[model samples]
Target: MSTRNPGSLIARIGASLIVLGSASAFADEVVKIGHAAPLTGANAEWGKDTENGARLAVEEINAKGLVIGGQKVTLELDAQDDASDPRQGTQIAQKLVDDKVVAVVGHMNSGTTIPASKIYSDAGIVEISPSATNPIYTQQGFKTAYRVVATDAQQGPALADYAKKTLGAKSVAIVDDATAYGQGLANEFEKQAKVLGLTVLSHDATNDKAVDFRSILTKVKGEHPDIIMYGGMDATGGPFAKQARQLAIGARVLGGDGLCADSLAKLAGEAADNVVCSIAGMPLEKMPDGPAFEQRYEARFHQHVQLNAPFAYDAVYIIVDAMKRARSVKAADILASMPGADFVGVLGRTQFDAHGDLKQGAISLYDYKGGKQTLLTVVKM
Candidate 1:
């Protein structure tokens, strides 16, 4: 048995094909962008939505005969599916490295994105995540790792504050699915909960494969807290919500954007009504170009777009815009151009800081009430 480095796997994935497409036409000039997410398995919806946003950006940019460095060029997407796994993320990252993607927009789950980022940074690939909000995504001093949305440090605490002050939660027990994204957020939320004067009762963990939460929930329920703050992607969050209800745990289930989506309504059924989660990006219907994106999405896929689709959309445009500004599709050109760049995007005007974090943190809180994802509050942190 042998293991392959991510840089080695980069040669065979879509990254290579996409980079090759631009290279063959450019006499060595090419602008290659890479994307990775869970396009299959339990959380496929989120992966596809991100793919749609990136694909739409590519289609629109190519249609215009993208002009960069006085050379007519094509923008290519080197996409792969990490399937929401950190190990698979390394595999996809190797593919992107081989393809030499100038910029990237993916690995939607923060747990995976945070680690895959080291690969991209080592390769000097500029990556701007459309959704991964874990604080460490940019905190590791990776100047090339950017996020269009705010970090969980901002999003998780906002929800925690609301839960304590608005919901009047006195005792709160935190639970996470033990993912980098989930635990990272739970860590922050618990810290913030204490700062906000909420009593910390207990903490629990769950993973993607988890189906039985009886033991943990029983202990959390014993705390008799007013709320259960969960930190995990939606694949498990929805089921946890439904299960918590069945177990007669009456506390409100609070979570970050990972649990905020329309499908949760279907998964959680009656439990969905009162479940609240923090959200990144504006609701799909409310973005500047959202209505049109929604209509085209429904026609093309016969499904509604989810929470972070707009952020993904903006991520692609930023990469393409960098190409146009550099006037060269070369990876080096894109990386040099992405930092400190400002652009108008779906979430509003956005700029990247030196470390690749958003210059001004932008995120919103959404509640899954009455079977729809509704915006409760938009915040800048």
Candidate 2:
């Protein structure tokens, strides 16, 4: 010790300090947030967009560093593919629960989201859907079930009103994919259409997997309604519209948020020009940070924003905001604090109603012009 060199001693002390610092850094708690969607099916693009939105939020939070309960923490997204199947959605929900995720941000379709919601509710984990618009999703009275978008209750009527007022349609024929989402939306539209004094020529049921619509179009052609309302996702709605055009139905196609997507142009080709659809939230261009967010999203993902990416992005931030307010990373605490969430994100002021639905929702009406989505107007609900 007496013969020890000062430089060597200093180097030894520095190495010890480095080791301690490393240990301290490693002590950060790891929190898991589950994201479930159809990553390998017809709606894969939409699902991937949702995941990318949540992922971007998580990455940004990590970059800035996160501290909860006076302890540093790192967030991780545990994403799973439900394949757009209700059965698969339940399985994925249970798996996420088993994995102990503090919260979940998906189940893209209302068909999947409705069934998977029970699992999250039972496990006391928050299930926030970015795109599921079926009214039943929030009507189930599950405290954990929440959606950032407007429900079919409002969206369906808005579409019907547009058909009656804007399109001046006196008669309409309805078709649904028979799934919870498709059938539910069709039902709501029919109810409102009847009230609006628009004659319902006929309401038909189709499967979500059906590709050919000649049979249905042929039947609807016989009825010769002014407008054909399709209640289904774009994957099916696009083809339905295309086949209707091929059959010379001449009726303009109308659909809900599921039928509203940028890819609809490619899917339906020239038929997209005749399609009018409604989104469950405000138009992207009208969002508070829509332009900047769109640029950042394109740069990060190297693609255009589909539907619901902004909602998903805001959803992740909403969850993180809860975590910060609660000062804890526990699922129960986060869920407890969600009722009071008033985070102003890309979608603007986000506060939930008593039923876990957006307090003040807005529906955006759009139509395709020259293979591009063009906004018509925004209706506040």
Best by lDDT: 2
On residues 1-381, what C-alpha lDDT tens digit does candidate 2 reach at each position? Answer: 499899999999999999999998779899999999889989999999999988988988899999998889899999999999999999999999999999999879999999999999999999999999998999998999988999999999999999999999999999999999999999999999999999999999999999999998999999989999999999999999999889988999999988899889989999999999999999988999999889989999999999788998899999999999999999999999999999898999999999999998999999999989999999999
**Overall lDDT per candidate, in order of appearance:** 0.82, 0.93
Off by over 4 Å in 2: 1-26
What is residue 138's positional error in candidate 1, in angstroms?
0.5
lDDT of 2: 0.93
Number of backbone collisions per candidate: 9, 0
* lDDT of each residue in 1-381, candidate 1, tens digit only: 768877768757867899988777676245678889999888888899888878877877788777777777677777899999899998899899998777788879997898899999998888888889888889899867988888888887888888987899988998998988899889999988999989988887878778777888888878899999999877788888888898899999998888888888887888887688887655565566778777766676677777666787788888877877877677677888887478986767789777787777656777776787778887767
lDDT of 1: 0.82
Q: Which ten residues in a row have the lowest lDDT in candidate 2?
A: 304-313
